[model samples]
Target: MKAAHFYLLLHVFSTASVLVNAFDPITTTVVVSVGAALGRTIYDYFHERCDPKWISFNVTGLEVDLENKLFGQHIASRIILKAVNGFMSNVNPKKPLVLSLHGWTGTGKNFVSQLIAENIYKEGMDSSFVHVFTSELHFPHPSQLDTYKSQLQQWIKGNVSNCERSMFIFDEMDKMHPGLIDSIKPYLDYYDKLDGVSYRKAIFIFLSNAGGESIIQTALDFWKAGREREEIELRDLETLLSLSVFNNKKSGLWHTSLIDKNLVDFFVPFLPLEYRHVVQCALAEMEARGLRPDQSVADQVARDCVYFPKSERVFSVKGCKTIESKLDYYT
Candidate 1:
């Protein structure tokens, strides 16, 4: 035991000596540069491997890594599994899965997709079945909208013949051409078999940023403002009416000022988990990565966004209230 201890001490001494006198100044400089390059390379590697693949920085001021950090705790895995099962069960002959992205103000459409992807895949889900397209910037290239319709219809007829339900998730669908809405009218049938096709199958999901009522409300606001400002109400209402079913208030449509009931039903909006929920998730994610929430940063984030993190209620509520109390009240 004494001899073993001696050897261990000697080994430790040798390691210390090696570290202390490893390199000359020039050699040390070269080594540091090389090490920095290697560090950057490793960081890049991890960054690419993350679920979002977009998080380059960490809350703790350290490098963020997806492949290393996002193991076994991703949330999206369950969603896809359930969606797959639902599609498989309801579909007599397994239809192509089409998931849409739709939500209104403060919705985390991209983040939701990332969570689902991270849950299932430590790396990334095979994107063939999963497409993450942003509706915000997808301005159709000239006549490409027509081309997309034709090709999609063709694909549906040819490849997706066996699929009972096709799941298509579209986000910010309001940005898409109005005519594009009419294109997918054929696939609306899920329970009823199409003509001679002897199967009940397929899910078509269209996620949009514009909700039924919000759009109506926004338009109404515009119309009201226009009336007040002496602008053209007819043209503005025409644009709103173009998308909605209610024309100057119809059967059960005048609930809100922005959108009609029929248009609301057309693209069912997937309600977002609240802003507080989003901040909570982000905070939790940061905490999981070893960044203890500092009051200064948390306060700034809360103040900037008005979103209190609910995951750590004690922290968020206390911090927000404290900050609020500091502000001078009006006389």
Candidate 2:
């Protein structure tokens, strides 16, 4: 039988089984249990379908996650919350929401992406409507650029066609072949439709380590001058970040039309974590693993992380990336 018909039959059986409990409790229990298992199977089968039941944007949840779970990124947190809120709230966006997150490793680029995904789709990263591409894994061969471009275009077109609200995330963009990303430029553009498919409602996120050096240098400069890191804003880093990413040969964005055409809606910068932030990460990890937050353990883990500016040691070199493993060793 059709899945939907089966689902409806199971729903009726579950409701009717509840009534049977008065006559035969054991039979009713078995019927209810079997109905529930089949119902779950049916739910998973249709989970990927594009509809309000499966996908809904929760702006407040996203804000809370970014504020509570994310550490040491006031600028990134604010920009992402606003950008995503505005985009999801709009019924008719001119183009797809494009976010290019740049930062040193472990500074929460990937984490922020996960938060966004969780808030938008019930299944988060596991949602079929959400797609992720890694540079080294997906497009490791420069010689296969032509083949990769064709496959990528088809992949995106196919997925977007399946669901207008699909999300695409590209990780390790710095290692991506320079021209490979340009393949999706048309989809990110403001075109109403390309061959009868509307991509305006889709979202594209690019995460990269490119332009991180400039971000670190700026943060370092601010620290050296004794200015509060919170005082540093997007204006101080946005322009510099775009220039650095565009000029850096290894950055997947180098000389790409994505930057030149202003297709990237935001170039969010994640600042390096400080000693205190690393400690917070350690504590948070312990709590996540159901362990009591130990200040001593957090402190030891923070101290174990290598810090930069050899003499000053102002910022974490790994940026809380190794906190989980370190916590394992300590606890």
Candidate 3:
């Protein structure tokens, strides 16, 4: 063993030995028990554990990330902060904290999830407690929906059994088999336990482009009326988002009970990115790559992206999705 570990063990045993000789039998027993617990705590501190030592909620970090890293998403930034803060602060939640993110690609749906993971898990996305499933890759065979359902349930149950604070992110929900996700409805519902497993402390995030059209339309309408995008609020899009996702047949959430039962707590809308936001993404990517921020390179990268509304070119066609690759070309 390492010298430090050997010394720690020696200290614990020597301290216990001293207590045993100095105190009565009963007192000695209590002291030894306390010593063991302290040793265990020390060990846990040095090692990775599923408890609070490894998982902590940092609302401040999350807030700062949403404000600084994320761009052109006032409504998303606000709802995400409040929703996550409230959910994480609660000692006993009725059900798993469910957030369904709907928007165009690269609108920060995945990035927001990453930020939450980073603040909660010491390992962030690499945490064993955090699981990601891409519908197109994980559950590609629609004909095997039954098998996929079984595997998904087992996966979730087994993981939650290991760590109640587990997080599951489902990407490309629009491509998932319609009824496949409903398999885990029981876990998402308000129940003390489903066959001896409590999922109340878990978090489930669904990412999909199912409602991008409605979200874009809403933003377009605001822009046409010469209203600031910041003026757009959750109230203006929540109902529309839910309806759009529910009615869209291709959406994996299409009439899923996860929605019908009101298990989903929030349907976050990511508005399409404008030219300025794309430029911000480029600059951020540059900084992330350890390069000095160059406005000229950022502008060139942003310019390379295709914009929509041919005449006006108000919004980026691919949002900030291609910013990284485009930046590589310019830089």
Candidate 2 has which clashing residue pairs, if any?
Answer: none
Worst 10 residues of 3 by lDDT: 40-49
> What TM-score would each prediction reach against the true structure?
0.41, 0.89, 0.88
Model 1 spans > 4 angstroms off:
1-102, 113-125, 132-139, 142-144, 157-167, 191-202, 212-275, 287-296, 306-331
Q: For residues 1-331, what per-residue lDDT tens digits would candidate 3 score against the true structure? A: 4889868876886687677778988998898888788778666656766888789999999999999899999988999999999999999998899999999988899999999999999989999999999998999887899999999999999999999999999999999999999999999999999889999999999999999999999999999999999999999999999999999999999999998989999999999999999989988999999999999999998888888888899999898998888877888
lDDT of 1 by residue, 152-264 (tens): 56555543354322223455555555555455444543324455442234334444444434433443454446542123233333344334532323211223322321222
lDDT of 3 at 16: 74
Best-performing candidate as measured by TM-score:
2
Off by over 4 Å in 3: 1-47
Which 10-residue window in model 1 sums to the lowest lDDT?
55-64
Model 3 TM-score (2 dp): 0.88
> How would you encode candidate 2's per-residue C-alpha lDDT over 88-153 as one tens digit per residue?
999999999999999999999999999999999988999999999999999989999999999999
